[model samples]
Target chain A: MAEVRVAVPPTARKGEVIEIKTLVSHPMDNGFLLDYGGRMIPRWIINRFEVEYNGEMVFSADWHVSISTNPYLIFYTVATETGQLDFKWYDDNGEIYTHTAEITVT
Target chain B: MTQKSTRRDVLKLAGAATAATVAPTIATAQSAGGVVVIGAGFGGATAARYLRRAGVSVTLVEQNSSFSTCPFSNTVLGGINNFSSITHGFGGLRREGVNVVRGRVNAVDPDAKSITLDGGDTIAYDRLIMSPGIDFKWDAIEGYDEAAAELMPHAWKAGSQTNILRRQLEAMPDGGVVAIAPPGNPFRCPPGPYERASLIAHYLKTEKPRSKVLILDAKDSFSKQGLFQAGWAELYGDLIEWVPFSEGGNVARVDPATNTIFTDFDEHKVDVANIIPPQRSNRLVDTAGLADGGDWCPINQTTFESTIHANIHVLGDASIAGRMPKSGFSANSQAKVCAAAVAALLAGNDPASPSFINTCYSLVAPDYGISVAAIYRIIEDGTIAPVAGAGGVSPSDAPASTRALEADYARGWYASITADMFG
Candidate 1:
């Protein structure tokens, strides 16, 4: 499974466009290269990524093989209320790697 | 069977790098020693079981109660297996006298001989056995980061991504391209990517005969190359295409927007992909200063003890074990060697100079398999080198019966290794 990390302000004003930065710990094995001995290393990369705010989808991406390992993303979302922001990375292999952060909105 | 390998010849390596760690005191040497083992995978779990059985008080610390294994995971990628079979629990190890604890090991303080858990509890040990295994070098590949893992599956660790790749294969349109990107040297299971390609191709051949599996390799050669290629030719025919680095196999970047991988030679569009990036020792292992700013921890191959630290031993993929592939069997073998040393060290006895062995079996299909095995011992140069002519790979032209038998051995090895570790 991938390790997803998120950085968000502890407090945000209602209706603020909060900047959310996230990082995931993954090799993103780009099933393209060979080992030192010249064999095709198997590819097992994450292919879909998504983020949600309080159960509402805010962003999603259809990813392929070319992405950074432990890929990081920064995006802006409106802080409408005190709720949890969920971040998820979907693996081509069929699992979802997720992380969440709680934001206190005034 | 070498004429020159006398006892003196073998012991020369021992003299070259003799470990200074022995029972510090005679009176306390015979007492039951405390050992804290971290990570309940092949290396840690096996060491915990063996050390506890050797009359040492062992604390097996793991973050999860259940452990999914990587040895048999290619079957999952082939679409013929599931997680339940490859995953296991620690009940057997606990019942066998190891004090198995489910907690995150937050920190390992070598000087204090103690480990702090996430909840603030601490467990001290006479010796620490760290089998934290390999972690990806996050930026080894351009655009291949953790966030992109969800976008590209590196099902190397044998967890959720195992099934993810299968689902992707299932969802791919018939005749769609399935591209696999394997990691480079010193990674786990050197022959894994080829085996994966073979098995996935089997799935495609059966489920979607028009589909194809493309392997983009970082290296020009691989372990059991003749065997894997032969298997591919015999079984998969023209369905599998392999591009080596000399021929533009290396991917330069990945763009999820188009589900495409750009290689030095050309850009590949695929319906699904497995992008395995570069790897190194786990982050925590390096954080503990065990790796000493290097990609892998340097250890005395004779005792598997960190040359840079005391009262600590590293096993499996984390250690710089020369000539041994980073595989589960190697970890288990290394764990046994480490367990003996830890037990002997605490008991105030001289640890034995141990021999290491590894045999990795990969299935090209359910009833067909290939293997590479080696017997290793420390050499006069103070390295863990393979014993000359001790083992070899399955014959590329071996009869079907031999391949079938290797397949059975693969299953047997999985069952036995899991039992040896967890129990």
Candidate 2:
């Protein structure tokens, strides 16, 4: 877990589709490159990222080694209630990163 | 086989007849609808990709293939990275179905909608997009030119010249002097040359303790100045010497054959000189009569359409995007807005007002980074202005955690921009 940036519109209409972009900062190392000692760094990477609104999953993605170090995900979600949008990323080792953003629905 | 005409056969025949009559006319119209794009860098590449995606054929003329990149060139100079790691293939553009031609453009005829290549091939275009990044004003420095670059490598365009400068730095004596001369404003990457200096200083402090790096800059302050200074103080204090223009560091000339750069009131000779020259729009824009003055192409900030030429759009470093620094991130941002406008105009829809964004990151060390971010909107009068309080630089006296986080943010910035442009 490194850094998380969440972009939620300041206001949205209820039940309207709104775009939200979340970018998380992590090495996402696939253990491919050789280290200074010429030994391979073990693969330790985030395998899945999910976004939830009020504890209900809205968007989820599975990533592979091909994804760059820091993964930025932009997607849309239907805004029904004014609540919190929680973003969580889980690594292969079960390390979880949680960040939250407050959104308002008119 | 068919004594009576079947419905399928009759429908097929009618469709074939219609296609036969319409196809030729459409083919002729499309062939005549040519596009000339200047500069084959990231901005040009994206525009070419999207235009091809939109079914508009393009002729992308670049002065060189295998463009070396300034983004990660510091790693090469520091001996931490190699050129192959940063090099990219144009085959991606080829796969996108673009005509990527390698040639220097001599002139542009906006009225005639024609471009003359260096080899005398005249190309006519219905629309022209100029993304030719930047060019140095040799006159800005009294004794600097292509010849002077032999020994004093700007390495700005990132190719063999970059390698030359890197090798020169590597081969210098442990105690030798390395001078980096950064140009004034309206240049590409306002924070880049400073970052390069910091990276070089990092290498010197670790590998050659006796060596020193001098940054002679033409500006009073720089992007991430506070953060970079703090890092330098913490990491390599007294190992790096920075002199702004007012302090007599402004470069006046260079005699590369003698390895000397003359400034007002003093002459500093060094073992290696990295001169980042003052820049303007690429030469093709000037040839096309699109340049207003000061090495920039003036365009309507709203649509990125050239004020000097009809049906021509200019984006990226080449355009005088007032208040927007010439950076890779800015270029990509401008490209997306331009793409939307082009798509709309082609679809017979009104071009929407465009908004641009920029976030520039610089590495002060391997794990330390700083950034400046801003969101801009086109004003009603066709000018671009930063949205008040939308984004700003990292705090000057940030904590260790913030600095470390900025390093990760820098990587994220790279990923985002590459995805927007090439992915």
Q: Which candidate should be chosen as best, given lDDT against the real structure?
A: 1
Report the lDDT tens digits of candidate 2 across residue range B302-335. Answer: 7788998888899998898878888887887887
Taken over the whole model, the C-alpha lDDT of each candidate is: 0.84, 0.78
Model 2 bad stretches (over 4 Å): A1-106, B1-34
TM-score of each prediction: 0.75, 0.72
TM-score of chain B of 1: 0.92
Tens-digit lDDT track of model 1 for B1-423: 455677987787556544333323322433534788999999999999887666667888999879999888889888788779999999898888888989988788888878899889998877788999888977777787887777688998988888787788878889899999886686988989998999999999998999988998877688889888889999999999998765557776787667789765468988897998888888777557999998999998878888988888998999998778899999999999899888777766788988988988999999998898999898889888899978998886789999999999989988888988886
Interface RMSD of each: 12.7, 18.4
Deviation from native of the Cα of residue B73 in model 2, angstroms: 2.2
Error of 2 at B195 (Å): 0.3
Candidate 1 chain B — worst ten consecutive residues by lDDT sum? B18-27
- Candidate with maximal TM-score: 1
lDDT of 1 at A106: 100
| lDDT measured at residue A87 in model 2 versus the true structure, 0 to 100 | 86
